[model samples]
Target: MIYFSLQTPSIPTLEETQAVVQEVHQDLQQLKPNAILETIRSWTPGLLSFSYRLLYAAIIIIIGNRIAFYLRRFLKRTFDRMGMDLGLSKFLISLANAIAYAIVIFMALEKIGIPSTSIIALLGSATLAIGLSLQESLGNFAGGILILVMRPFGIHDYIVSEGVEGKVLNIGLVYTTLLTVDNRRITIPNGTLSNAVITNVTAQEKRRIDLTIGISYSSDLKKAKAILERIYREDPQILQDEPITVYVDQLADSSVILGSRGWAATEDYWAARWRIIEKTKLEFDDAGIEIPYNQMDVNIFQKTIDK
Candidate 1:
């Protein structure tokens, strides 16, 4: 009997449902203005801080530039007195200045509320990727440092390496510049130069000049040697302390080649060799010694007619 008129609870009408949704929306709208005001109030301090940070960054940049410039100039004068190459000096000073500026910039960013530690950690994590991407550049950088330390060759020194021969014009951060005798400029990577076989032709004060003279088999070997020795002796450019050696070195089908080695000042090596060559020829002509050439003897006669 109690359940006889139990009605199924009626679902709300569409109108009622819509009215509830409208009420909820109005409440949200009323809260939005205050939320917006609170948001702006919170951002005010941040905006003011941002402005100060910008000003500080500008100051840091200006001061950093001046400090970098001053350090570079000071290092330049010091390096010049130490006989450092101009190229090397510039690289070192610029590197120091760059590091100084980088620190200042990072500090300014920190002052602006950026987390410097987090930035550094992120950079450290990415280092391997960066290095892998720039492997050649990193290698060249290391090679430059090695070159500076080893001092294998300096500017204006004539050197041959990696199949290239020239006078070093400049040693840059990544490459070395060379000027060939024909006036061709070559840029060689420092990484390659650091590992290549280097021949410094003018590193020493004295160098040996080698000259070869060929004479006929009938010519007196002893007489030719004597003339060469005398010629080398008379040349003032030849180093007197070092012994000059002249001997029959090779016998070709046509003539006997005399190998002579004489020591001379590095600057005078070519001149001494040329002078000795000319003098040797004159002495041979005067002494009636024949400088032989290749000639073939033929006996062709009646056999050709018979054919």
Candidate 2:
């Protein structure tokens, strides 16, 4: 019979494991510096190229912005030379400036590795989204275009619309600015202004001034009429070619109303009206004419009750 011996494999000792760990740690320490250097060496060219592109884009933006500003100034001068309508000129200038800036942005983007066609596609999508979200703004833009085409009013034209009366300061892409009589600035949407009933106050070269002056019944009606006619004739601002009439407008309870009508240069309407009214008061005073005031006379009688 053959005898077989079973032998178990010997496991590694703790010292042996510790030695292997030390060898691996030393090898990693020796490779660390070279690995870092290799990484930097590999990335340097790409980093430099990206940095150059970034700097070039920045330069493009700066130079392009300056060019856009100068272009706008040139356009403004050209429009002024052409005697273009102030509102239309301003609007066109704004549009051109916007286009120039857009071109600059696209060029800068291309330098930064973004394609212009891609940008245009992105803008198309964005515009569609914005158009749906901003319908009112789009309406205002359309209205502005209509205003430019229709020529109903212009910059510096005094207009009254929707209870707002003022001199138009600007007609912009979406808003129309007005400077009020009291020097308040008002901004109204172009859409609203376009749809509203606008009264062009200064459109005509001449305007008629109608004044109603009331005198007491005791005062001479013919004398009051004569005074009004004389005031209209004497005023240099009033137009002599236009018909000037003073008539008995109404007979009220305590006074007779005299209606006076005169025509004057549109620009001089207020001055003529004020001057004539002042002269009428002075003339009536000298002629002993009385302007009636609203007065109430109350009479009370005492009644005694006896029980």
Best by TM-score: 1
| Candidate 1 lDDT for residue 122 | 86
Per-candidate clashes, comma-separated = 0, 0
> In candidate 2, what are the lDDT values of residues 172-251, reduced to their tens digit?
87899999999999999999989999999898999999999899999988888998899999999999999999999999
lDDT of 1 by residue, 256-306 (tens): 999988899887877887888888889999998899976789987764455
| Positional deviation of residue 278's Cα in model 2 after best superposition, in angstroms | 2.0
Candidate 1: which pairs clash? none
lDDT of each: 0.88, 0.92
How many clashes would you count in candidate 2?
A: 0
Error of 2 at 222 (Å): 0.8
